[model samples]
Target: MAYQVLARKYRPRRFADVAGQDHVTVTLMNALTQQRIAHGYIFSGHRGIGKTTIARILAAALNCRNPIGSELRPLAEPCEVCESCTEIRAGNAVDVIEIDAATNRGIDEIRELRDAARYRPSRDRYKIYILDEAHQITDAAFNALLKTLEEPPDHVIFMMATTQPEDIPQTVRSRCQHFSFHAVKLVDILGEIRAIAAHENVDTDEAALALLAEAGDGSMRDALSIMDQAIASAPVEDGRPRLVAQQIRELMGTVPNAVFERILQAVNDNNSAEVMTTANQLLDAGNSPAQLARQAVRYLRNSLIAKISGLTPESAEGGAAAELLQISPDEQRRAARTAALFTEEELTRFLQTMLRTFDELGYRQEQRFHFELGLLKLVHLRRLLPVEEVLSQLAGGGGGSAPRAQSAVRPVAAAPAPRPTAPAAPADTRPAFSPFADTPNRERFQGISVGHQPEPVPVAKTAPPVAAPLPVAPPVPVAPPVAVAAPVSPPPALGVPPVVAASPLATPPGAAQPVAAPVEVVSPFSAPSTPPPPVPAPAPIPVAPPAAVASPFSAPAPATPVAAPPAPAPSAPGEPASHLQDAVVDALSNAKQGSASDAIGDANFILDGDTLKIQTMLSKIMLGVVVNADAEKILRLAVRQAGGPVNITLLPADPAMKAAEKKAKAPRSGSAQAKAMEHPIVQRAQSLFQAEIRNVIDLRED
Candidate 1:
């Protein structure tokens, strides 16, 4: 009486009905047959791929009293006639408890379930708990049910399903076996659609079916729903369904293959007008800019795939042919001939432009204009050289003649030179004035000279310089001096040097005359004279050479006996005096004396390879070496010299470490140090000489 949505109507009823999940189904059937079912199971996969469906089917199989037999097991298929199977399928099963974890995600609900799980089942073989979207369960609920899940009652079974399996915690995952459901494949979905179409007696074309399958994108429920819509919208003539490609294409609002071909042709021909016309045509045909952009991206992607795989239309696969213009055999042969004309990089650049255009269209109100402009630019890009090419030409390659000509047609500013010199000045008479002539110090003009050299005049000395005396004729009457208190003598200057006066002049008798005072000048070089004590120089203290101060215990004066001069040291020189060796020995000795070296020897044994290897081993123990060679040697010698008695183990050098060491030590053609570091193995051996002595002495005594 009522129309049921295809998603609900086509919901999987049994394990066999589930698509693209044979591994999950077979495993569950085997579990039921062997009676080795766990108290809980978790199912996970993408949406609309039957995670919840499989959970329900498993619930039925677990409680099925009358089971159908198969080759591998006696209960592979649960009989739908059985009361438990029928009830579960109808969603009225008393024993099967289905809970939506999304709605009931709380500690209290889980506690109640845990308490109720203690009771025996009312009327079924097992009490099933199917929790959908189990990842949505609250942390408290998971913690509360952990104990019950680990050791649940014999009759209670938990079946959890989630689309996002990664969100589930490890504690829950470890408690139950996980079954992953994959998306249904396109071919499998098409098969299911065909079956449905036949049952409904709808006449659908192969191309239309392929479009539906491509649009479904690996979801059976979505494919069925799309098919239902397509069938309902099919134009009817004489009470028959007219399901064709054009009708489906109209329903989807996708551009046709011919339209995509025309767009590509316009771009290849560099026809801006055609590109704009095609864009307008698409708009007039009621296609949205976003949809057009998506179709263009798909078109470019298909072309690239076709160019790569060399598949022709006749031999092309279903979705590939519908979305991509299938290359004809002749075209494939031509593509090979023209392959050299366009490189992989060029195609990639073109595809990138299309993608960028799509992203721009998202923000653009005038998307058609932007789309047309993008296409025009992409078409003309081949005729124009890249900016890098132009730079290379200007850099002196001379390969950008055509591009340079096109660029010159437009007025562009020339590039500025890196270091432009100042222009030469002309010979001019009147003193050349500059805005910076008012410089504060005449010292700045010391090195600079004007062309006109004026003669230097002799100086006339000793004239009182015709001193302009104060006008003597006009005398103003003077007031009697007010008895103002004399200004207190200025406090002594705080380390300010005393000022020296050049000359002094006396004032007239009745005039105010300034007084001059004598000032003391301190010279930096002058020393204060002091009386010397009359004492004869004590007989020169008998001098002792440094050699005389050496004690017997002190290292016997580094035998200058003979400089066994400059011969190559022995391969295993005994404890070469390196700061690194001293540090390592100190650390080892400290760790041993303090009883903190329980794992030090083992840790050292692990650091004998590359720096990363050493770092990794030391990181585990929260102890690391401050010295490079010392850490490497301590590790090597601890293992080698420990004499198999101590619990020091040397992990074999990691292959990656060995490779890295080889790279580090390998002689680089131009580098001096490369030749000096030596092979890593040799360097590692050399580093161990001192550590070997220490290890022998320390562990041998132990």
Candidate 2:
């Protein structure tokens, strides 16, 4: 007779024989008793978990020839004595057809099976077809089987099984009743195998059996096979050499817990030499570098679980692994005690490093380099503390570092020193940057520091922005330019005379007009373009409140051959006009100078609104400044310095029109009036209208 391996020798023959699957067996037995069997059955589960075994048992029960009932009904369990049951068990039952779909997965083979399935069973209660690895069938074969699988003949039953349930098509799977099987637990696997070992009369200890069972990973057949191999190799001692864990480790080349403990101790000691030396010893013992890395990960993973759950060694996976690996109790205690050396963060980091080493071993051609460097790296790495602890140390709120340098940790001593009566030194005010010296704003940016940025120089309050606005011809109405200056400002106190401003060419009122000045700019003939009414000395203009009293005309009105009046100084008699202007400009320039200082020069301001506003007549460049944003900023600063702090805004100025009057008496040129009347567009209009041209007027066409 030929020898049978333990996997097949211990194969389950009955549903009750399938261990760890009582849930499935109990349900199936009830279904059999009630005679409510599904014609199409699909069993899905991992390998070596009794999927095919259970399917064969179902076939046997369905085809059993012997009866157990008092009258004639057959039992769900096979009698095992009759021809049908015996032949099926022996794999020779003609009525029971078994197919390895992995080898015969073509559509033609499935079609042939479908045709043969139509025939009635040959001298049996029913015909059964058990197809294994059903997912290996091609799409065409699955499609061909769908119809037959869904509605098969009453005499035929279909059973399908696969390790990979996901690969099977839903169309085929939906036609069948599905049952799922799970891996047997570690305890159950060891209990069964140890019983088998005792029956075989092999004196095996708990350590050897546990190691074989753990290597099984969850499958009973796998555990039995590993044990069978170990038993065969067992040397004879007192009729049987006890199967020892050391022998098993040698056979399997597994890294024992001692190696993991040694590496961890070296890491705690920060001894790179010991870490590398211990790792190499494992490699010398015939364990692969990746396997060593995996062992370290397992050890650390167990430690983490134990630490978090507060579980003792007996209750944790680490205890099981240690017992199975044959690690001595004293060595296990030493390793377990080291768990105190790691914080949660440190444990997490250690696990990460080991996992990375394991992954890199697969892609790296130099596995030895990865193994040596990995353990050394862990030794060199510093342990990490919790974030809260580090923060508290920096804040001087947590316990200080250890005294006398017992540990590597250095405490943060950032608590402030007591301040003296004198103020602390201000941050360096001098500029440290010199690279921008070539730019146009270099001078302005100089002497500016982070904490002490250069402030805009405030305007002197002795005089308001010196403005004397001239009425120019109205421009085509465009979008109003944004005003960046303050209100119709405090009048310029020392520039143009206020009373003399009644006429464009008139001198100061209440002051004698000088005669025979070479700067006489009177034109021989002037057009009637301006009003002749003498506006009061201090009465405000109605059209546009002015930003400054600028000398509007290009012809110099002789530098009033006399010193202008000193500005009204701000007094305890309430804030003076100049001071109010200064205050308002200062507040504006300091706060919003970057955006709001553009209308400083051109604004015809209105000081009535809470926010000073520029009138629309804000016009052409004044004093060679662009009358734009930069100019506006400078002028605002000046007002702030000269006057006092005042809030500034830009609103449209007053819109009252100026009074229009005849031009004052002056000599008129005959040639100029004749020239105006002789123009072709004018002549055509006069002729077309049959009107006479009289007293021609010049519109100053230039």
Candidate 3:
């Protein structure tokens, strides 16, 4: 007999046999027991999570005969010996139909299914339709089946399985009862592996089985497949089954614990040389660059977690590291502590560098060199100061420089004072000969004095008197009396003018006044008399008037002023009013107006000023218009023709408008209006134009 592949040979036959999906199993069993079966069922989960297995089991339970007690009847755990259960398990059941939605996803296939559902089951109580990868079904097929799914026959059951639940239409989902499956846990996966190994008589350790469980990645099918490979690789001794960690690792091409440890130690010690050497060794051993990079990052992350929790690498528990590296909880904690020495930012930088280097490694034929280079760079980073210490040094300048002096001093000797009998004073005003002066210990003010010295009188000398030119007398003017004004007194009697008071000690008020004062005044006047005129008084300052105070009961101000602007002089009645004449001329000019009843001609007009009153033979309309004196008169006429309360904003023609108009009028292969009308969006807009014509006045380009 040919050897059956483990994935098929050990395929789950019943809900109880399905690994890592008890929740889903229990729910389905309860639904069947209570007879609360839904017409449509949707099973969604990752691949190998038993979506297809549970779906088949549910089908079996519904059709199983020879009821086991109520406890087991109508549940997922159907007896394999029963006809319905055994046939479904073998994929030979007549009533249970399995469809691969990926291949048969078309309207024709769905229409056939809809027609088949009208028939009764051949053997079982109900006919079951199992659609795998149901998301692959085409939209037309789904639409075709929508009516059938919403109201299927009493003897029909629809079981749809999809890994990507999001792809299914909302309408289809609303018609079904949905079940979500999760990946199997590591412990649960390991337990299943142990059970299978025991059944197969294969000898294995818990650690080896745990590794296999991890390699399975939560997929029972994958785990069993790997187990089959491991069993085949096991050495044969008397046909006994034997498996070991080394064999498992070798088969999976995983790095050994020792190699991982060596790489980790190199990084921790900041030994770039060792790190690169080890990386080269890994490559020489046939490890791919991407695989090596993934392992390195995993190791670093595990180390960080261990370091933060103060655990050795062996002690660390959880995360990818726990699942990949077979490190003990203690060792994991130790590695984590070592990783904690570096900051998250630093580690993240290292990881990013590794990522970039890995990208380069992929393209390089000689990947060992680039891989080693990346390792060396990462190790070198460990030698640099940690981010915190670097930040501290930057903040405070390392706190190791010398202090600087704040002040300087110098000594000085006193200079000799001038002779006391002479009027000249000493160069240094501070006294030098005082008893308390120049003493460092004396109080600041105790050594100081305050007083005035009398001026020295001129000494009368006994020199020979000049006897010649005997006694020439000088002319002396009469002295003027001091005049003091009193409030009620008339201006002081002018018999003698008030004396200009002379400063005291100026020849005792009788000395001749200086001649230099009059000479200085005369010198300034001798030059050109071009003195500037006095500044004029500033113009009267305008002050804002005080705000008016209204009585408490005064009426509120109108929101808008009611007074209308002055109207322009009406055109002479017989002279043909400007508006009517312009309208008549415009009517006569537009002879080729498209249609016989094209009212008002092609001319457009605007109303002028406020309270626009039109008096036309056809009808009368009032509109509000405000026109500036400089505004174009033609625009005012255009506003008047617009009629009603239309707000016709007349803008000054800008440079852009002039350019556009020029372009529009230029000769071309096609009319500019026709070209503009050609755009699909523009055509759509034109269709909508009439409906939105009333809103045009309020439309702004922006």
Candidate 4:
């Protein structure tokens, strides 16, 4: 007999022999012992993890003449001694049939299967049909056998094994008992391979066995296959093959995990030179860049997991680390050590970068360059400070200063001090929300030359007025005189412009003192350049003689100052009205409103003292847009920028009369589309192309 590979030689013949699938094995064994068998069974999960093996085991158990094991046992073991079991295990059973659905996936084949399932078994008690890779079966094929699969004959059973269960039609899946299998764990694969190596009389180191198990990636058959190759490549000593970790590494086309650990250490040290050198060495040694990237991604993933598991490298033998990182104990230790060198976030970023590098290497032209670049990125990534950290430093005022700063302008000359007889009045309390609380802010914006500044008015100080002499003839007594002061200039501050101050008005003796109105400070768009004209003082109130008694019910009338008419807003100096209009047009054009700018550019702009008038021949829609709130705001801002007048008015240029005159001067002509339709050559071209004219443009001027 030819020497058989370990995969087929060690294939499980009974459910109990299968590893990592006890949940499925136990349930099927119970059903078999109690004689509760379903007509259809669908086994699905990761490949090489016992999906098809379990299906075959179940098939053998169902057809076995004498099934062993009592109710207390985990499974009803198939008795190999029986003739039916022997024949089925040998793959020559007359009643049991195994079909590869990948090749025979069609409606006709399914119809034939449906016809064959109706018949009773030839020798065994039941006729079983096993379909492997059942997901490859066509939807029509599944539908063809749907009714039969739902309610198959009692003498027949259908067993299916697939890697993807979702591809199976819902109607067919609902009619079957679905059992999902899990990937064989690392420990289980390690134990199985170790036992198999010992049984095969092959000498192997612990690391070699671990490497083989890790290479399996959660598949038992894959591990066995790789072990078979490893045993073949091992050196023979004393008629027994000797397997080592280095030999296995060479055979699997992978370097030791320590290589990746060193790279990550370089990353932690922020050594780009070391990282690129390591990548160059790996590539020069004939290892694939894509393969290297793949290995790096895997290592980084394991390291990130180790960091997230919150385990120390020394104690990562058998807890969450062992459960999540499905590698050998040595590899887990390496991952844990790498994780310690960086933070959780840094490890996560490294893993993401390597994953992208691996994906890019699949189609990249210069794989080596990109792979080195990716590793270099890890080094730079280590130097980055977290956003929260940077922000905290900034908020704590420990970070570097901003890139730019503004220097204060020179201070204007100060006005002379007021006389001692005229005491200054108490300063007015501004509201909390007022923007003028800080005078420095105003001076900071003095660079803007848009509107004229208002002249500053000096604050006037008033004293208690003296009472007038009584009109009674008895020699009226006179009150003591009170002294008043003239208005004074604003406080001298740096960067502030010199304010034009006004003189105080004179008053007759014994007259009442009039209070001045509070100055109105407009928006930043407008500021004072000149002071208002002084107003006349009010007339004095009459008083009774000192000897006479005054009326207690009568209240003294309050004295209020007369308000002067508002001064006209000053226009921008040196900026002509036409130049300001052109500036406004340029501003609108810069704002990306080309049509609006063109329409406004053609309109007439006239400045009449403080008022600006705009006359336009645009339509009502265009007119509405020109006068809309947004457009009006833009116009005002443009005017301010150009240092023009703020008060603006818009007027339509007699739309009805203009429209009639334009119509009268218009030439008599056909529409462009109508003229194109009348052309014989154009009609022929349209007929030949089978095209419709959606739009027509006339190049000729009217």
lDDT of each candidate versus the true structure: 0.57, 0.61, 0.58, 0.71
Local accuracy of candidate 1 as per-residue lDDT tens digits, 1-702: 688887777788777888889998888877776878888788888777888888888887778886457432255676677788889988999899999899998988999889988999899989888998899998889999999999998899999999888888789899999888877776678788888878777888777787787667677777787888899999876676767878888888886656766766665555668878888889888898878878777656656666665544455544444334333333333333332334455556667888998999989899887777767765665455566666765577676544533222323233333322112222331124432235333222221211111222221222122233222222223223211111111111112222221111112234332222111122221122322222222232221111111111112111100111121222122222122223334455543432223223222222222221222223322343332345544533433332211222323434456445433432322223333345576467769863221121123343
Q: What C-alpha lDDT does candidate 3 achieve relative to the native structure?
A: 0.58
Candidate number with the higher lDDT (3 or 4): 4
Off by over 4 Å in 2: 67-75, 314-348, 380-382, 386-702
For each candidate, C-alpha RMSD in Å?
28.0, 21.0, 27.9, 17.4
Q: Highest TM-score: which candidate? A: 4
lDDT of 2 by residue, 1-702 (tens): 799888887777777778888878888877887888888888988788889889888888888765545233355677667788778888999999999999999999999999999999979989899999998999999999989988899998999999988888999888888999888776778778888888778888777887787777778888888788788888988887579888887777786676787778778777778887877777776788887787788778766654554544444345554534333334345445556566566777888988999999999999989988878777655444455666766666567443222234445433334222212222332123334324434334322211122333222334333343343332222222222111111111223233211112323334453322111122111212222232223432222211222343223232222112322322332222433434434454565552233333223334443334333323233323333455455544554454323455433323342111112211122334456666798779878997654444446654
TM-score: model 3 vs. ground truth = 0.52
| lDDT (Cα, 0-100) at 323 in candidate 1 | 34
Error of 1 at 165 (Å): 2.4
Q: Model 4, stretches more than 4 Å misplaced?
A: 67-75, 387-702
TM-score of 1: 0.50
The best candidate by lDDT is 4
- Comparing 1 and 3 on lDDT, the stronger one: 3
Error of 3 at 434 (Å): 24
Candidate 4 versus the native: TM-score?
A: 0.61
- Name the 10 consecutive residues with the lowest summed lDDT in model 2: 658-667
